[model samples]
Target chain A: MANLVNYYIQFIKRDLQLAVRQKHEFVLPLLFFVLILILFPVTVGPESGLLARLAPAVGWINLILSLLIALPRMFSEDYENGWLEQVFLAAVSPSFFILTRILSFWLLYCLPLVICSVLLVPFMSLPFDIWWVLAQTLFLGSLLVAALGSVASALLVASRKGSGVLALLLLPMLIPALIFGSAVIEAAQQSLPYLSPMLLLAALAVFCLTIAPVAAAQAIKINLG
Target chain B: MFKWLHPYAKPERAYALANRLYLWLWPLALIGLFTGSLWGLMFAPSDYQQSDSFRIMYIHVPAAIWSMGIYMSMGIAGICALVWQMRSFELSVLAMAPIGAVFTAIALFTGSFWGKPMWGTWWVWDARLTSELILLFLYLGVFALFYSFDDKRAGAKAACILAIIGMINVPIIHYSVEWWNSLHQGASITKFDKPSIAKEMLWPLLINIFSCLLLFIALTCYRFATELLASESHRKWVTKIIQ
Candidate 1:
């Protein structure tokens, strides 16, 4: 058990180290989030009320879309260089490798976006009271993205084209997370009971956590043969 | 558990089974469709309120229900394909996607037609309607995925994986949409009292629903046979059948 844990820890460490080496991989989604959220305020006119009203939804969508932007990059390197092939050849389980990859992705791709979303809370004219709810939902919601994104990245490994099919495959699956996460924000905005949506979001993330890695491993093996 | 049914796992047996079943199913489906449509369209009493507009429900409701039903079946077929590596089940997964998509489209069109008169709008983002739209998108995603692969087998497998994901997420999508809709709009959707459907209206509706199911299965069988032919075209049985 200790050996298994240590083995997976190295995979996670390797992935995080790779992200750290490229530092821009971490900054890209965050930059996209800020730039696009800024565009919304500028384009929609300077009205605080509309910006505040649109804040939760607009925030959630940009976060999701920017994460979509970061998706193809997630696996293209390892897939093209045959790193995945070497891992599978070593008889290391693909699911463990995939789960740790997703965990590091959550750290690199989703974590920064969630943190930046909290920082930009003021720019969107969001209610200060909703930040905690917003952050909690973003944190949970993006983990679901990492899970689903792992499956999609695995899928992309099999398919020939990189055209926006990743977005098509991942976006629809993320609707529940989007709806649940946004509900948490909106409920907090109105000061209504928000606990249920928050809990549901966590449940959803947990559910995806169990299924996605296995499914992703399956996708990889299907293509491998 | 599935050991006794092992014979049919061969592509030839599965194809022959579908071919034979479709032959019987076609007649039943046609008769049910003809009689049910005639009765529902002309003989079934017009609703007390909104009169004939409610008749659209006969088609709309059945299509709506079965779109969801076909999606469930596809999910099962997908599991069969991925887990058991059943080649025939893979054909069914591919065959069923377009059918499910068409059913979802019919439901949406009929729904808007009904909505125009009943709800005073051509469309509304009601929870059910929105979820149905999402279902249509899921079908399209599976359909598109299948075509995108060079190896049809790989395509089927990938599409099946997607179908499984959709099945898991569909309920969560529906519930979350419902919760979100409730937050925006307060109980504005008109409720249909199901037990109140009259016997005259109910009978034809039931008939139509049954006919639609038979027709859907028949079409799936037909599609399965044709696709099985394509996939097995190089085999002796296929050449023999072609002869």
Candidate 2:
């Protein structure tokens, strides 16, 4: 048990150190996320109510997209360098590696989105009360996105096809999260009980957290074979 | 039972069985489709409310049901392939993708046509249509994933993982959509409650359902056989058959 824990910790520390060294991977997606927020108001016109109404959806879409943009980095580096095959075949289980990657991704990619959305919320004219709800939804939803997106990244890591197919495969599964995240925000906007959708998103996060690593491990194994 | 079923674990035996089944399935499918369409389009009494627009239900409903059915079978084939490493099951998964896509497209198109006159709009964000749209996307994803790989076996395995994942998600997607629909659209416009279906209408629909299933089986079997043959052309049995 201690050995397994040590392996997981070591994996996270290694990936985080890589993430710090290659700050561009983190900065590029962050820039894209900020650019999406800035561009939406310009494209849709600066009407505050419209922006408020559209903010939840636009934010959620951008959140998923930004996460997606960073997804290729999740496995491609290891895959390209051939370390992924070594890890898969190594004494350490691939699932732990996948889980570590998912955790670090949520920290580096998803965590930043949640923090920045705090600043963007009031700028978009959304209700303050719903900000808390949006925060809750984004936190959970980002974890789900990271977990699910890692699976897609693993599957596509070895394939020559780029992010288009990855998006095609990932986006549909992301819908429920998108729907519930925005729905809870909308619910909070109307002062209705938003707890149900929040709970549902939690369930989805838990479900993804459990299944994605195993599936990702299997996908990596298949790709390696 | 295990003894009887053991031979089919071999791809050669399975392909032969699928080939034999296709011989019966295609003709039966054609006859049933024609008969069902005739009965549905002409003999079935018009819906009291919907009248003739409801005749589209025969095609739409069957296509919709089979779209889901094909995915379910694909999921089963995926599990079999994963568990036993059966090449036949992998080929079946590949063969079923286009068939499922076509059926899903039929369902969506016929659904919109039926919707135009009934709901006064060609599209609605209701649960059934929304879920069907997602199913279409799932089918496209399967196709995209399959063709993206250089190694066909690896592609099939990856697509199988996706199929199994998708199969698990379908029910959750359906339930979530249902909840979303109920909350947003109060009392669905697309509810085809089985208990409410009249006998006259139900009979023709049932026949069409059977016909559609036969059509799926026939098409899938033929496609699987062709795929099997192509992949196995250098093998002894394929050589003998070709000779």
- The model with the greatest lDDT is 2
For residues B176-209, write the lDDT of model 1, one tens digit per residue.
8887788788877653644488898888888888
lDDT of each: 0.85, 0.88
* Candidate 1, residue B232: how far the Cα is off, in Å: 1.6
Model 1: clashing residue pairs?
none
TM for every model, in the order presented, reads 0.94, 0.97
User: DockQ score for model 1, please?
Assistant: 0.65
**Docking verdict class for candidate 1:** medium
Candidate 1 residue lDDT tens string, A1-225 = 787789788988898888789987668888889899889989999788888888878778888999988887777788778888888787667888888888888888898888888755688778777776788898999999989998887876767775478877888888888888877887787789989989989998998998999999888777677
Writing each residue's lDDT as its tens digit, candidate 2 over B147-211 gives 88888889999999999999988898888877877877576665575348888888888989999
Instruction: Provide the RMSD of all predictions against the true structure, rounded to 1 decimal.
Output: 2.0, 1.5
The clash number for model 2 is: 0
What DockQ does each prediction reach against the true complex? 0.65, 0.77
Identify the CAPRI category of the predicted complex in candidate 2: medium
Best TM-score goes to which candidate? 2
